[model samples]
Every structure is written in structure tokens, then in C-alpha cells.
Target: MKVKIYGEGAEAQELLDKVNNSLEDLGLSDFMEVEVTMDEELKNSLSISKTPALIIEEEAIDFRDTIFEGIVPSDEEVKSMFISIIGGGGESSGGCSSGSCGTCSTGCH
Candidate 1:
């Protein structure tokens, strides 16, 4: 799994720190690769409309999910996202299985 944080500022770096901390806390430091990017092409390809956006991709199956855009998620929120992804076998449990659960509050769709 890989996590990419898109932006070019302290906020982006802070998100990176939070992610690293969360991974360390969850004993998943070696399970994922984390990076912060300010590449315009990458941001455009991901259609990132805001700074400090986060994208989580499971490259094994070419699965890419946008966790958030335009905002900074809390440390716990970031941890929960990782938990959901790991526990659900790459499918985030916070999202609706049938796409009918609507407005999930777990920061995933």
C-alpha cells in the first residue's frame, strides 16, 4: 500500500508526520510507503482540487482511493482509515458495500 499526500506546505508535511505516527502506532511502519508530493502532473491526474489532499492506493490490484480533499483529517481519523483498509482486505469497511448506505461518516465513500 502507498499513501500520497498532495500539497506543498507545512500542512502537507504535517499530514505526512501524522501518517507516519499513525503507522508507527499501529505497528504498520513497514507495510506501507508514504510520500508527500507537489507535482502538478500527479495532482492533476488525481484531480486533486485542493491542497492537503490524501490518496491511498493499493498497487497490488491497482486500487486507488481518495480519502480526503481540501481538509486535514485528524490523526485518529487517518489511523482509522488505515485500519479499515487493512482489516477489510483492501476494501475500506467505512464505505458502503452496496453504494446505498449513503453519507458514510468514516471519511470514505
Candidate 2:
């Protein structure tokens, strides 16, 4: 899977960090590639009218989807979105039985 984050400035960087953290927490950092692009032409091509848009692509299935337009999603939301896209069972196996462990809750698992 490929994840692309589009935006500029501090907000973009913060969102990028959140995405990275979430991916790492989910143990998917090694399996996925992430890219951040602020090219206006690229954004135009994607028809993204807002900054901080996240685009996910799965080459094997020729699937391309976009989310988080104009708003930064929470860490859990981002993780869940990716999990759903990859068709994972979405059950975290870490020590967060209540789904609220410190690491998991802070998106730093």
C-alpha cells in the first residue's frame, strides 16, 4: 500500500507525524510507503480542494482513495482507515484490551 499526504506548512507536518505514528503503532511502517507532496499541479490533478488530503493507493487492486480533506483526523481514525482499506481484521493485538492504552491512546504504540 502507498500513502500520500498533500499539504504544506506546520499543519501538514503535524498531520504527517500523526500518520507516521499511527502506521508505526499498527506495525505497518515496514509494509507501506508514505509520500508527502505539496505540488500544486499534483493537487489539481487529484482535484483536491483542501490541504492535508491523504491519498491511499493499492497497486495490486488498482485502487486509489482519498480522505482527510480540510481536516486532520485523529490517530485512531487514521489507523482504522488504513486498516479498513487493507482489509485487515482491525483488531489490535497489543496490550490495549480496552483500546485505550497509553501508547495506543496517544497514537504512539
lDDT of 1 by residue, 1-109 (tens): 9999988788888888989999999999998999887878877777888888888888789887667777777776777667666764355444332332343454443
Could you tell me how far off, in angstroms, the CA of residue 42 lies in candidate 1 after the best superposition? 2.0
Model 2 TM: 0.75
Q: Model 2 over residues 1-109: C-alpha lDDT tens digits? A: 8888898888788888988998898899999999899878768877898888887778898876665677777777776666655557545543332334333333321
Which residue pairs clash in candidate 1?
none
Candidate 2, run of 10 with poorest lDDT: 100-109
- State residue 38's C-alpha deviation in candidate 1, in Å: 1.5
- Candidate 1: count the clashes: 0
What TM-score, computed on C-alpha atoms, does each candidate reach? Answer: 0.79, 0.75
- Candidate 1 residue 51 C-alpha distance from true site, Å: 0.9
